[model samples]
Structures are given as structure tokens and as C-alpha cells.
Target: MSQSHTAVTPSVNKVVLAYSGGLDTSAIVPWLRETYDCEVIAFVADVGQGDEELEGIEAKALKSGASACYIVDLKDKFVNELIAPAMQAGCIYEEQYLLGTALARPVIAEAQVQVALEVGADAVCHGCTGKGNDQVRFESTFAALAPHLTVIAPWREWDMRSRQDLLNYLAERNIKTTASATKIYSRDANLWHISHEGGELEDPWNAPTDQVWTLSVSPQQAPDTTEVVDLTFDAGILTHVNGSAMTQTEALVALNSLGAAHGVGRIDIVENRLVGMKSRGCYETPGGAIWYQGLRGLEELVHDRPCQRLRHQLGQQLADVLYDGQWFTPVREALLAAVAVLAQKLTGTVRLGLYKGNITVLGRKSPFTLYSEAFATFEEDEVYQQKDAAGFIRLFSLSSRIRALKQGGLQ
Candidate 1:
């Protein structure tokens, strides 16, 4: 059951809403004004979901009864500040999800708060439902950044429960909306990836239909011949795609096109949500997959065994923190600092072959690579004395040897 925040709400004269111009937010603009008798300002964060989602957003907000709408272009900052660091650290939630939706929230929420303060708004509202992780992500950020502002979550207050209810409410109010009841999937898209949830995904046993995917083609529908992509990285940040230099954002855009052509990134998983429930989702992240693979290839050459293990641990921890909306904390900064050190020598080029939803490493090269042909040679090598390994192995296994002797199992 959704609890009502308005039962004993604080007085609010103006409120800023994180609006998407979608159904929920479209309804929310008018609801905030009617329910609280406050001025509603629509705030849209453009994190490169696509031009289609952004087109006519301002007009939609105005039609929905917003006093004004502020669209913040967060594309550059999203890739450079959030995605770059996470990508460099190899942060993938639950070993599968690329943290696509999770990574976009903090930057969007931070920008929302900034808009709220700029307009002297008393409250900040979001259309996130109470059952999901986004409510926590958005409100947690608000609490950390602006503790004083009142937070209004309509899902926790309104009687509306379904998309049908939202539609009926809009109709009663004579407000126009593009949403329809037949819209089966719930999708969230940004620069890195697109996520699909709801509908048939509610049943874990069900396989997603072809309609669930919007970004990349089905592997079966992919090209017959393999396409090779060359990725160059400097200090663990993507610097170029193919032979042409590009900004990180531009490189990602190009990579997305190339990888998607061959069906390079697609995953379906049942993941544990931050709210303590298992939910199934499908994700398409062609460019991000290529980016991650390129960095990993570089790490394989540059990272020593210990550094490799430590980086793996860092990735898991950082993923957890980011997924749980803890990105604004000191612990995340500390983890990023460690990742920066590990990534310092990760300048490299990785050649990958993409074909039918697969990415194969064709070659990897790094200036700081630890690989030595002379030492690793199968033939006799003067640089490494194989005979000396016996004593070193004995020393390394001394603890095990002592444990066996103590148990009288030395034989």
C-alpha cells in the first residue's frame, strides 16, 4: 500500500519536478499544482536518451500546466564524469547489468536540486513509483545534497495506481498525453544503454519477445561477416574509435553504431534490486560493451596479478555503491582514487571483432604492458631460470606443507 506524504505535509509555495514528459510526469505537473496549490516548474535532464524523447518536451510540460521548464544538457558531464570513471573501474552490477539506469540518476537528481535552489523552490518532486529503486536513488541524493527542501513523491500520496488510472485522470482534467494503454514495455534510455522492464518480464520463466529490444538487432538478424573495431584509450578513457580521434562522447556514439550493426551487446538477467526484490530486465549496451571490453583488454596487459584482483574487488564495490545511490559519498571517492591509480598505465589499443552478438578480442597492445615475449617464450629463455622456480614454489607453499605435516598427511 502506498503511504500518503500529504497527510501532514509542509507548506509549499513552489516545487521543481524531475519531469520526463512521459505519462507519469505529464500527469504529475498538473497534480502537483492542484493538490498542493503550488507553482510547478518542470525540470528535464537531457542525458542523451535520444532526440525523440527530448523533442517537444518543453511544449508538453507547458501543456501539462508547468510554470516553466528547464532542460539541462547533461550529456557531456554524464559520459566524462560518471560513465568514464565507472567504465575505467569496470563497474558492472551483479556481474551483468552495466548500471545504465543507475548511473544516470545521480547527475539528474543533482541537476534537479540545482534548479530547485535557483528558482527558490520549497520542494522537489519526482515521478518515481514507491515500489522501485529510483525513489531511493532520487530522494537519497536530495537528502544528501539539499536536506532543507521538502520532498514530494506523488506515488506515495495519490490514489492513482495504474497507467489506466493516470490516463483517466488526465482525461477528466482535459489534458492531452501521448501515452496509451497498449504501451507494453517500460523503458529507460540514456547514452550508455537502454533498459526494458515490466510486462512479460514479470514472469522469470518467459523469454522476452523481439519487441522488447529497441537498440540492437537480434543476433540472428546480424551481419554474416565480422567487423573489426579498433579502440584507443588514454589514462583509461576512450580517446578514439577506429583511426579517427574523437571526444569520449563522440567515440561512444560511433562505437554504438558499429557495435549495434553486429548485435554486439545484449543481456537478459534476473537481478536483485536495491529494494530487496528480484526483478527481470533486458538491456542493450552495444557501445558500453565495446568500451568495457577495450578497457579490460588494456588491463589484462597492464595490470599485474595483485592489481588485477584489487581492481576486480574495486569494480564490485563501486557497482554496489552506485547501484544503491551512494555515489555522492566519500567511500565512492576513495574507491575512485584507487581505480585512478590502477588505470594510470592503461593507455592502449584493443582490436575487437564483432559478429552476431559476440565480441572477440583480435589483438591488444599497450605501452605499459607487462607482457614480455622473451620471458613468456615456450622455448629456452635466458631472462627466466625455470630451475629456480622449485625453491620459490616450495617457499610459497610452505604454509600448506606445514598444515599437512601437522595433520600427519605429509605423505
Candidate 2:
């Protein structure tokens, strides 16, 4: 039987929970009921994890004593409003996976807040662990959107020590769970990418096993043939592929098919978590991988070197702040402003080669491109300024020469 709730209890009349139908969230249902003596309204955000994951989520929530279950379909909004903007900015963490989970939080939290208002709930709850980045993400959104609602985080209050303990507790309470005692990996999936943790992935040096990947094939196992893909962008937004216009979601789906077949996007990194720990994870972001590279190619055609460098630097900083879940801050707004200006002229076409997990930019062109053939050609041309390089090189090396002279030439 599940133990009775004893930790911090809510005095509110009703609570809206961000339910996922997962092990932790399933346990949260009964625990919330017993502790708060309040009606629980479960809210599930469907952000394209597929029907299998969401099929019986509402039923499961109701079975666990929730007064009602609300499953909001946020797939279109998620892709257009959230994913598209991040893609335009070419945002990725550690030069690997797009910040999929991190980006999903704000939208999910927003939906949860709306549900809370619709159901007249006085509080909101989530299943995020104390050590995870999601706690910050969800809480920050709540702080920004519905600060009046009391925030309830079960992980910080529950005495559950492990997944095993949760299972045992649920079993004792006759709460059936499909989760087994020995789960080899912990995964978080969405339209963007699938993340793998635990098992071999927890060890930074260990190579990911085949069983760990659910999305893309291993590069070694990819086909021997190469594939070419063409992409078009307009005002920092992806539009056409191979002369066919596609919706944002459709474009991602097509890119994912091509990129995954070529083993294009797989990454393993030890990333710093918001909880002050470095966790190793393997990420597969096939579609996002191709899109980001393609966007950069277009950006390169239009933006000068100095501007590109500044934008890339800003991207790195934005990655850290986004990963840390500071999405509502003024700093984030300033960073996005910089990215918007940099991406304004990013309109062009990019041809890419995909072979055995490698995405290589073959060609890129743009109307606003700064590249000049007359100035770059090897043959003598009217625009040639060969003698001007002497002055340019001297000015560039002026600081170095002064530093050497001040240091006694060779000290």
C-alpha cells in the first residue's frame, strides 16, 4: 500500500498539476489527494511526443483520483511559436542538440497556468525533480504568469528515495505502473530530439549502446550511400526544401527523415546542470541538426565576419542562459534582440551533403551577400587592391609589434 502523505500539505481547495502519466507524476496524483484533501485537475501538454505516450494519459490521471484531466494539444503552437524562433536564432547548447526540453518548459507552463485558471485551481504542481533544470523552467514561468497560485513541487517534499521506492509505494496502494524496476535509461523526447541518460550514457567516457537510441541509427550502421538536401530560408525562417514549400512541422519532419538516414545528428556531452552537477547525456537531434547548420550557411552568406562572430558569441551566451531557464529575464530579451538583428538579413539557399552522420555545407547564396567575386578572384581584376593589403597587414600587426618592442624585442 502507498504510504500516507506527511510532508508539506496545501490548504488550497483545488490544484492543477502538469501531469505526464510517468512514474513520478502517477505517484503525485494520489499523494496530492491524500495530502491536500483538495481536488486535483491534471493537465497534460501534448507537444508531439506521439499518440503512444499520450494515449491514455487523461484516463490514467482520472484513475489516480484527479477530478478531471485536460489534455491540450500544443504541437502546432510549440513548433511555430517556440521551435521556429529558436531555430531562426540557431540556438544550440554546447554545439550539440537544440535546447528541446529547455524550450518546451515555458510553453508547457503557460498551458498549465491557463488550465489552472479555467478550472479555478488555487495552486499548480509539477513532477520535476529537485536536481533538474525543469524545476527552474516551470517555476520561472509560473512566477511570470501566475504568481498568485501556490507552487507545489512534490520532489522536494516527497521521501521517495529511488524509482524502486516509487514503484513499491504505488504497488502497495494498488496503483498499477508499467515501469519496471530495472530501467536502463532515462529519456525525454519531443518533436526536436530525444535525450538519453543513465546506463552507459551516465559515464562520460562510455560509448552509447545501440539500445539507448530510439530515434536515429548509429553512424557506423548508416547506409553506404550519400544523400544531398537543399534548403531555403526567408527572413530567418525555413520555407522550401528542394523547390517544395512546407509548413514548419512538415519541413522538420522531412529534414528529420533525410538527416536520420544519413546518421547526421548524434552528440554526447557532459553538460553543467542548473543544480550544480555535470551530467553526461547523449542526444540525437537529426532534424534540428540539419536546420541549424543550414541556417548558419545562409547567415554566413549575408553576414560579415565581425557580425557573424558577434552573433555566434551571443548564441553561446544565450545557450547558457536558456539552459539555466532564465527565459523571462531582461538579459534574455536583450540577447534575443541581438539575435533578431543578426538574423534580419539571413535569407538565402543552402545546399548540403549528408553522408554517414556528417552534414557538410556544399553551397550557399543570398541576395544580400557581402561576398564579391571581383575582389576575391585570383586573376587580375579592376577591383583588385593588392598593394592595399600591405597597409592593412601593417595596421593589423601594429599592436603585436609595439608589444614586442616594449618587451625588449625577444625577452
Candidate 3:
């Protein structure tokens, strides 16, 4: 229930900011320094938002009155540690969202906190708006990892109401900004996906136009020919793509290219935000979608019925935990432990056909597969007896039969 105009006492002499060099964060640098009379250090986490966003980011931070700027490359760690675990656990928030932006927040916050400690800062700051989930995500992380460090959320204290307000504020200070009020969308992107919000997206009834998409072509505009890509997994971790061995980052990058060509990962939904509000967004998660299909196919081949059911339960719990910004908690650790055990036998290969937003599983193979052709075959098999099915059926329905008899047949 935090508002954007809350008053707080300023006690910190230095603070590290989770800077994205965006309109909000750029303005935050000068605001924090002026309001608190404290030295501000910008901390940027390069979790593969792309080179264009990162280009000249340090210089921009410096130009915005930050005493120092630290841009840390976290792509490998992000994929291997955050995205991989979420993928293995089947963590899709609300059964449709990939948690792309949600997953990136913790890693970024952790890095920001690290920079704060290293630089001897008394507090950490972020530009997350009070209405959004990122503010909770960032503050919760700061509380968990570095409880003693003061958390400064400028959006919760500043009087700026909109992007235009921020732009005007910067202009008044003679600070140049790339932001324009005419821009229609607010976006967040990383290695896994890109999410589009605001403008047309804020209206649930509005169908996103071609202009809304950046990562993939429209399904209607996709090529007619289907593309088949082979994915290999080792103990639930993706290891290869199309018969070529690749590192974790390399595999994801490759799959992204293939999935994007087919428009395989665009989703538009009205999701429930953690702050008890509904927000509409369009997400492009091409590589993540393909990777999810491959993992699911492999899981189906290896996991038994009970194990599969339990894994599904774990996945739901994990999704909520990750989405709610409880990453550094014991509940998350326990869920991850359960997922890791279930994923031990999830080694396999999956061949999928991607065509115009559709992913079709062509084939699946696993060394630890429990599928038995003899047991499941429709034809005569030596491993089973037809006569035994009668007893199983009777036993399986015994409770129902007893209940019916006790209640005088069909009553």
C-alpha cells in the first residue's frame, strides 16, 4: 500500500542505485544526490537486455551526476543460475507468464547490493515505480540480503507523475534525455524475453499491432515452412541444440533465433500483479518457449505418473515463490531441492517443429525413460494378461460399488 509521495528521513551519506539508464533511473541519479545530499553510485547488471541498452550506459550515469558507475556482466550467471532453475522447475507464473522480468530482478538487486557493500554505501536505491511489482521485488531482496542497508525507492518519494513529468524535470535541470512523451510503450527486456506494457497494452481490449512486437514476427507474417530443431538435455539442463554442443547461453541464443523466425512465443494476457492489481502485457519469450517445450517433452518421457504429478505441484509452488519475490527464502530453497531431485533423471533429447506460433513435438528420447512399448502396445504382448484387468477394475471401483449398494443402488 505504499504511495509515490511517502516522506522519509534521509540519513545515508552514500547509496548504490540499480540503474538501467532509462528515463526513470537517469533522473533518479540527480534527484537522489540533490534530495539526500549523498553521493550516488550507479550499478548496472548486464543480464542480456542487449548491447544497445548497455552502450554508453556508464557515461550516461556519470553525466547524470553519479559519482561512479559499475556495469557488471551477469548474463552467464543469470541463465545458468536463475533462468535454468526456473525452467527445470517449470516456473511459468499463472500458467502463462515466463517470469522473465520477475526472474531478472533478484539477480540485479543482488548485484546492486554487492556494489553498495563494496563501495561502503549506507543504502541502496532503485527506480521501480510504487505501483509495479519491481519495487516490492527490489526492496524484498534488499531486506533479505542486506537488512542493515537502507533502501531508497525514489518512485515512492518523488512527486513525478509520468514519463513526461520526468522529462520536464530533466529539461529544467538542463540534462539531456532520450525519453519522449510521444513514445507509446514501456518495455523491459533481458536474455529470456521482452515484455511490453503501457500505451495500447494498458487497455485490455486492444489487440497489439505490429509496432508492439520487437523480438518476433507476427504469426500471420511467419514463414510457411516449419523449422525443426533438436534439443538435448542432461539432468534437466539444456546442453545441445540441433546436434551441436553449446554452452548454456549459446543454446538459448540459438533457440531464440529459431523460435523467433516462427513467431513461437508471443503471449498477451491480463495478469494479477502482487500488489493486488491487474496489468496487461505482451511478452515475447521465443527461446524460453522452445526450451520449455523441449523440457516438458523430456519430462513426459522420463517421469512416472506419480512423479509427474508431484513435479507439477512443485512447479506451481515454485512459480508463485519466484513471482512473489521470495527467492532468497527457505521455502524457495526447499522447492528447488525437490525439483532438483525430480530432474535428476530428466536427461533426453526432444525434436520440435516450430511453425507460426505453434510448437509441435516431433520426437523424444531419454536414457532414463519409463515408457515400455510392450506394456503400452495395443497389439498382443507377453508382459501382460487381459484376464487380470477384471480384478483391477473391480478393486478400483470397489468403494463406488460399496457406496452404491449401501445407498440402494442408483440413489
CA lDDT, every model vs. true structure = 0.92, 0.85, 0.90
TM-score of 2: 0.95
Best by lDDT: 1
lDDT per residue as tens, model 3, 1-411: 112435767688999998999999999998887788899999999999999999999999999999999999999999999999888988888889999999898899898888998999999998888888888888889999999999888877877888888888888888888888899998999999999998877778889988999999888999999899999999999999999999989999998889898999899999999999999999999999999988999989999899998888998898888788889899999999999999999898999999999999999999999999999999989999989999999999999999888887843
lDDT of 1 by residue, 155-267 (tens): 99988888998888888889999999889999999999999998898899999999899999989999999999999999998998887999999998998898888888899
The C-alpha TM-scores of every prediction are: 0.97, 0.95, 0.98
Q: What's the CA error at residue 195 for candidate 3, in Å?
A: 0.1
Number of colliding residue pairs in model 2:
4
Off by over 4 Å in 2: 1-8, 403-407
TM for candidate 1 is 0.97
Ranking of predictions according to lDDT: 1, 3, 2
